[model samples]
Target: MKKLFAMLLTVSLLMVSAGAASTQSSNWAQEAVWTAQEAGLVPETLNTSYDTAITRAEFCSLAASLYRIWEANGQLKDITPSSVSFTDCTDEDVLLCASIGVVNGVGDGRFAPDSPIQRQEAASMLHRLAALRTDYAGSTKNKMPHVFFDGENIRSWARSDVYWAYNSGVMTGTGDNAFDPTGQYTREQSIVTILRLYDASYAALPVPNTEAPYHAVLDYSGAGVSRMHLEDKDGNHLLTDFEDTDGYFYDITVFGDWVGLMWNDNANVALYQPATGKRIDGYIFDGIDEKNGVAWAWAYDDENALVVYADGTTGKKFIPKTVWSEGRAIVWANANTLAAIDKNGNTLWQYKTSFNQDTLVYGLGDRVVIEQDNTNTLLANGKLGTAQTYTIIPNKWSANYIGGDNGYYTLYDQNGKALTGSYANALDEVGQDIYCRWVSDTQYEYFHCAAGGNPTTLFTVTVTNGRPGVLPTDGAGVYALQTSQNTIACFDRFGTIIGTIQTPFTLDSLADITFENGCIRVTRMDIGADTSTQTMLYLPTGEPIA
Candidate 1:
């Protein structure tokens, strides 16, 4: 009887121990560990300790296995492993990772194989791995914007990699704006990041429909309240349910990969990367404008405009009224003074005008066109020449010529030298050496003129209003026009009527029309005891976007 009782007690203890071990392996990382083990990337005998910090050598081994798998899938055939030597990490897998240029030593011929891998170091390694693929090469140079509060803590060498990793969803922070770059990278985090990298490399990237580069903010009524919406240039809805909870008026603008939400209430602004929906801190601008990838913004509570680069570095210059175009800002200092400033806030050139308040400066690819009252002056390389008085073609600032009234126009080169040409009133400059000419009051023709060649008409269109409401930057020749009936008419550069779309509400009910990157944005006002505004977006093709 005594022996039976002792055996039963021992069996019960064994059962309890087994239960505890099973529970430990059944957590969130259990499937990942199992998958890695099955693929032979991780040892089957390894005990699952998800919370434990990963060592350098251990991570290298895992990375090597992943690279080998990728190579087996025919993605890394050009990548040949080179010979490398490290004092500590002499293991075959660790050496393989180094030879493949995915891992490096900590100097002094040592790999620090047993040392815990820091978060930033892991990010760097992952970035290197991603660079091996052509699809990800463009992202490798992307600088880390001010997305985190502790972004300054990140080492310079690791900034790009860390930024790419975080924004691409390969890694996340430990809550708040802190990235914890110096903290230990745990086994669970490493596995998760590796999986995410794999998905990013193999998944189909999202592509916007339109080739134009612009984003728009629209407002509408839904569920008995006002809501704001965001749309890309392709008319795709990005944010459809954004509410103005504070009841503040706002404006939206895009600067390269960053989007700015400027509000009139206290001059508050919010910046975000539309691609990743990640909020970028440390930038305050009342208004933003961009040319190429360089941007200039009106700083809050200051008279100066801040020039910002893609890397989040800024330079300030005093400019009251500024408009950015073709990598330069044309600033109107005072009534008679206009200066062209580069991205570094250096004045490239200055011009004296004869008008104030009625003066408009437009930057066009190394040329500045100053229009005041009824006169237009073209300034290039410190030389000022008068332009024809006709409405400077509605779009195409870089065109060497200006169209005049009564089927007349004048052509010139960038240096303001007159180019001899017999041309009609150009409605718009569609592309390089291409123009949309007015054939009649209701007709237009597309003409292409090659250098040293006669102009050729490509197509013709018969429409009521060939005049574009918004400029075509994509060179596709498509135009959006507002018709007399408050409807939007879509016409090709050659005057072909593609389609017509009605407004969400009515033009009479709206206050103004704004042309944003081929889309029409309008605001409707409800003037009562308490006034309110609603904005809407319409594609150039006349289709309403959300």
Candidate 2:
């Protein structure tokens, strides 16, 4: 039961704002730092305060706040804070002792609150709070190569307590991997530690909808479809109806500040200032000569590119054969070139070419003047780029192999260069070893390879009486051999049977499995042990990690 520092909640994204009593403090304001502060945990002050000025009463009150916040937020479930006040010295001592699970009451007993909590007294409480079980917990002796610095502080009786907390990430070492169990807990230190344990107790708890600090104002109706609205962080309605149109609409797309609304048939499409609500048609469009609301017809002659609406009039005209034949008429611009007409055969804008035009166009509205050594794209009228451009770069693997969330896993050769020809879609890294399963229209097989790339052998998995022409692994090469009885077997990179092991646990619907903190974490499970009982299987031997 070594102190587990893994429970240590790294201070992430927490802004150290002004404490509860700052310039913004008001008579009716609920304490800003109420949760941590009420837990008898003092808010970290920017300015120095009197060393011993804070009284025992204040400490208890703060501790109470921390306890309440944790409980209300589902931080601690099994244990709850008592409602009894501890003004008397005896009562105070008892409250502290019981809060940390130091002692339990005999038949008809009274706790001595006035007495100073001793080393043994505190140790007992810390031990229980650490939640150590002799039989169920992991053993550290020789399992990990390490030594404790303050090993002497742990009494023989409370050694298990100290060890459990250390191993469970609850208690961390001062330095040199040691738990100073005998050290007196400070008011601040104690409150912080207890709050941490509270956090770990219900780390996976979901927040209630009513208690959620923020929410999204979803446009379930027509407005979210036709018009765009911007809201504040607290979902305050800020900007509404950016387009502000009342005619037949075809499609609307937002590319940065530029919002495009295409009209269907023959409808007047108006662009309004999101902030001012003024008509901004002239600024958005270059010229307006056709009818206010007219439909467009396809160009009868190839020389005249029809750049008009679906009804018939020329809404926006451009040169013929400039854009792609199959795609829409939407135009895209890059650094050096002026404009790019979409497959729709309409030129959106024209840009003056610069000498150092970069071909790497990223998003829809993103535009810069510098030329890249890569792709061809352009920019129009000093607008920002959107992250919608599709550019495919050659990787350690081929473009055909990337589809998952990790984007694409390109296995590098020993020289750390991308191997030109080796690529497959169904490949994954389990531990340091990589496995590839070949999937085709017919079946899936284990693709074995000595190096990271280029499979040498394929072992087809034949499921007796199984469906035919259904490659479960999608033609990638190797299939993780699972028995009909749900047992796990490991095959070498060469598709040779290494060994077999019982499946530690069955994940009902694992959307993803990834490695983090030296362990494999499966996402999308509703119940069961998130960490324990799900041990990593030994691939080389096909044995469970015991």
Candidate 3:
């Protein structure tokens, strides 16, 4: 086996050297092309014609080969496509690229393999590759204040990708402050661009330990503030300085193998596959939500409904706002309609609801809960479940509990055990065992229970504001409550006050508080002046982020 490995390496090296030999390159591209050959990025047959326009097939070959090598380097999964066939092209390289998701067909399962590739098209392909190689997921267009003078020439679909490719320093524009987005991209240009992307991340980022879980943090390093300092589940360091930044503002979350980063200012969202070290950016959404291990980023759709997307990390596209993984065949719905699509986004089912404002649509795993006019209908995603009139917050089928109505609610565990026997005005889960329930309009009670143990009241507090809500914490089992109009109190499972977070302005009628683990955001709206004030802070401690 060792001898065979050596022989393969020697053959690969010889082919790389032969490709590097007599490679006639333009003066500007000579070194980059040679470097690409040395790194074995270009094909062995790509020994000449450096200035010739790269065909769709040739670029796909290059991208596909490069990505295979890139993914095999300490990659944690085997997501590479093996057998892909296009009607118009049988080129193995094109199939390989298609398999890896770098390129696609034109129409009717036909790949226009011989077509001359456009610069922006190359940007789109390489942008997809960058998500796999450079961890350069997310949008910089919103973060950067300027646009290319020829931005109007760029296609709307390629806009975010072009911005990402340009700003990440992987690809550059044509001169004269123009991108020349439609310009032809040459073989040499593709080689150089791939190498630049390769240099950005190849071997630089060690694959994260997949056996454990990780989360993101912002802390001061020796040079400056390290924005994405990821830590493991045990609070141990995992990776630091995850993405290159000019010290901008953003927050990141890890959902299983995926890490989602959202810019607080622009509402721009990016996702990272920590296992593969690839990123998906350019999603401008209000927020990301996860339930029962099914996570999705959401934004407003047309007619002011919710549009949910499967993170490109999953290689899935626009899915309906279904909550569970098995709900893939289910359609998305507003309060009025339910339209179902297959995994391929085909409309296989449709139902229009005549619901009013009081309707509640809840998802539990693959099953669905629909409550309208005090009548609840529970649907099994091919499974069996019971429903009631109460609003159920879906957890595992075991921990699912109904919501409060008329200022009182009940709680139940997954095993059908009643968690709260007493009447509770409101409730929120603070930890796996700890819960904070409102016993009255003004009094808030925090309690805990073992898996099979009884509920133990930890502490009771009468508040001045009594807003009936708990501030969200980084999933580390800490609960934050607005103790007063102007202050927030954070607690652990034991009802211990972690700290009191203060707001920048008065908590007016339209005040809103949102946060990640390391950051707390408070916004107060003044309709009288048509203005709003927002403040950012370190969580639990309430120290200003700046």
Between candidates 1 and 3, the one scoring higher on TM-score is 1
The Cα RMSD in angstroms, rounded to one decimal, for candidate 2 relative to the true structure is: 20.7
Per-residue lDDT of 527 in model 3 = 69
lDDT of 3 at 199: 78
Model 1 lDDT tens row, 174-255: 7644688899997767776776666555222222223535456557645544344556677777644334434223556666
TM-score of each: 0.38, 0.25, 0.35
Off by over 4 Å in 2: 1-246, 254-259, 264-355, 358-416, 419-421, 424-438, 442-546
> lDDT of all the models against the reference?
0.59, 0.36, 0.59
Supply the global lDDT for candidate 1.
0.59
Residue pairs whose backbone atoms clash in candidate 1: 219-535, 461-495
User: How many pairs of residues collide in each model?
Assistant: 2, 75, 7
Model 2: lDDT of residue 431: 13
Instruction: Give the CA lDDT, 0 to 100, for residue 442 in model 3.
Output: 68
lDDT of 3 by residue, 1-546 (tens): 545544554465467655465346777876566667767788977657778888999888788767767777843244656567888899887887787777878888889888998888988998777666444445432122124544535554565567567766677777634678789998888888888877775211212213437667776434432345566678876434454443233556666666666544544566666566676665333334332134544432321212244343342444344543322434444555565543344455456556533455656434456676665554443332454555666532223454555657666543334666646556775554566677667687867664454778866766556544443654433555565667876555444555678776677557666654224567776766557556555445444455
